[model samples]
Target: MKKSLPAIAPGLPLGLLLGLSTAAPRAFAQEAAAPALEAAASLNAGDTAWMLTSTMLVILMVIPGLALFYGGLVRSKNMLSVLAQVFTIFALITVLWAIYGFSLTFGGTGLFYGGFDKLFLAGITPDTLSATLGTIPEYVFVAFQSTFAAITVALIVGAFAERMKFSAVMIFSVLWFTLSYIPMAHMVWGGGLLAEDGALDFAGGTVVHINAAVAGLVGAIMVGKRIGFGKEAMPPHSLTLTMVGASLLWVGWFGFNAGSAGAANGIAGLAFINTILATGAATVAWLVAEGLHKGKASMLGAASGAVAGLVTITPAAGLVGPMGSIAMGVIAGPLCLWGVSGLKRLLKADDVCDVFGIHGVGGILGAILTGVFCAASLGGVEPEGFSMAAQVWVQCKSVLITVVWCAVASFLCFKVADLLVGLRVSEEDERRGLDIAVHGERAYVS
Candidate 1:
């Protein structure tokens, strides 16, 4: 019998040689694929510490800033009710974020929502590093983002304040956070589809501001007009409370715009300066509009102007120079004032506290202006192939997408909540106000 040897495949020798030849390159590539957990060059340890502090500062914005902002805008009878709504919602968002919101917003590998591997914060520990944060603790990043979620939900209350049922508000908030907010957040920030397309949001123009504004508008409509709306003379019960809240928001906003840089660097510094200038310019611009149109600037107008400035500068804060921020502020002030006053009347939407006016309009303006003002010379990171016009078109696309997504989600949420638990307070609750009717507590004991 002939000695038979298993014949080697024709390509086996070549494959073996090729595999051996490429092994080192593959190993090298593997070694290179691991990301550094820290920055290439960290400057001041103090700077990092300050950023951590600022992150906490922003937490104050929604927990109290937004709570009191909406609280003081409603009637005195509904004051505590609104306050209750804000407080409870803040706590709810905090818990939900710990459970799933953070994962949904920041989890890996999804177009509209994040993955669930990090659900309930599993595997996240004191040492877990944030890939985007570069050595910053993942816990720190989560805490910072939690505040944004809290505020975004709180902002919607302004649209249906004093009229919405407490139970309904609670239910809808939890639902909408899961359904609308988290998905949009993933799309915008969490390495999702929009980010892959090179959209520059810097902060949360579409995610937070526009998201809340659109939801608020839809809730206002679906819940239907308040009993005395349009034909009534409803005024903010306490301008003093509104002023305090606005002031806190102004102070806390430093953290918001700057901390968005995710590092304590030159860009953060520039963002800080722009936030201040833009807010001041907008306040003055608002007063001017009120004086010219109404013969006197209202305190409410001033507060709204401050908010508008904050909203307008959010997207461009890291991208625009101080001058660009000031320009945006000047424009946002009057334009928002007009929208809040006469524009609501023209549209007849009964947006209770001008959510669409301040946030929606401001978000749009800031997003578009970001395209014009983003320059490498102005603390901006210019992406490859991104031009001003291209960026503007991209921003518009983002706005339109946000509007449609938010509109549908909000409408559906409101409708469902309405049918299940009812969106509006009873008519008796409306005339007597929600504090006594809904919460069964009077804001004033005296």
Candidate 2:
């Protein structure tokens, strides 16, 4: 080495030689780190695209899907009121979610609530990534979750439709969304107490369906029954519109369930097929039950059954096999029928659209059965050290916590609305129907 260095390094110091020897390895390491840095920052185009589509589909569920579904179920006198309530709630919640809702939901590590670290979505740019979702941009995740929040508030409107004051509805929605919806979402999906305790909710069995149902039940009781609820026939004015809305809900629910998987991978595919199978099975089961009970299957029964099946399979969409989904659907149809009829009479609450019956009952059934079917022995993608009994107990605990939280918070929210603006319209306004009475517009001018 000394002989070779004689030409150019004749006067080179020993220190300079040592420095040069170490520089080469350092340069190599710097070069090697460049690829890893790039990889860590890179976004998957396919996943980003899928998530964007999923966000749009969920929005569809709130607007025309849920709006029409609830609208058609109410009397013609309150049709426009239902439509207006659903549409306005969607818009209002979307704005709130962008402001502080997202932060309090997914920002902190708290057991009950997240921090305000992401208020106004601070510091999150297009380049930002979701730590939980990993492959998609953080913006996509925020948008997707906002839709769930909006629909949850909208779902409560059906329970108090045709009677609640417009101003009261607005005030109650804001309060309940802040107090109940946000915290429950954190507990189940945002890695809070239930999540840490291993409660399985693949898509929103606890957070969306049960949470909204409990709120709906509370509202139904607090708002009082519609005028002539049991005395008069309050049949649906337009079954055709309901069917269309149900169809849209069915289509959009694919995004709700499969998109929970967060990627266009095998799990998403599994969820998609399960949704179709379970929904179809539930529809048939409901038809059979209705025919046996009433000697005829109405279109309304079919639509209700389909929704029951959809809600039942939502929590287990990605966790269980197709056959398991079918079983859940079959059970949900009959159970929810009883929920709307017998259970409705038992509770003595006039849930206009049966939100508590289908969504509440179906969600509870699906959540508990998910624990049973999620075992590897039952053809599910089991978690590590999976035990059906332990998981079912965990599911029950989560459900109980959610029901209690929602019922209490909803009661407070309704009381707040009643204090500030009054919970129900006057007798004259209610008798005249909410459409022309509240909004000064008619759904159909006769």
TM-score of 1: 0.89
lDDT of all predictions? 0.76, 0.83
**Per-residue lDDT over 125-232 for candidate 2, one digit per residue giving the tens place of the 0 to 100 score:** 989986545567889889988998999899888888889998999999999999999999887766577766777788888899999999999999998988888998
Clashing pairs in 1: none
Roughly what TM-score does model 2 have, to 2 decimal places? Answer: 0.91
Worst 10 residues of 1 by lDDT: 3-12
Once fitted onto the true fold, the runs of candidate 2 whose alpha carbons sit more than 4 angstroms away are 1-41
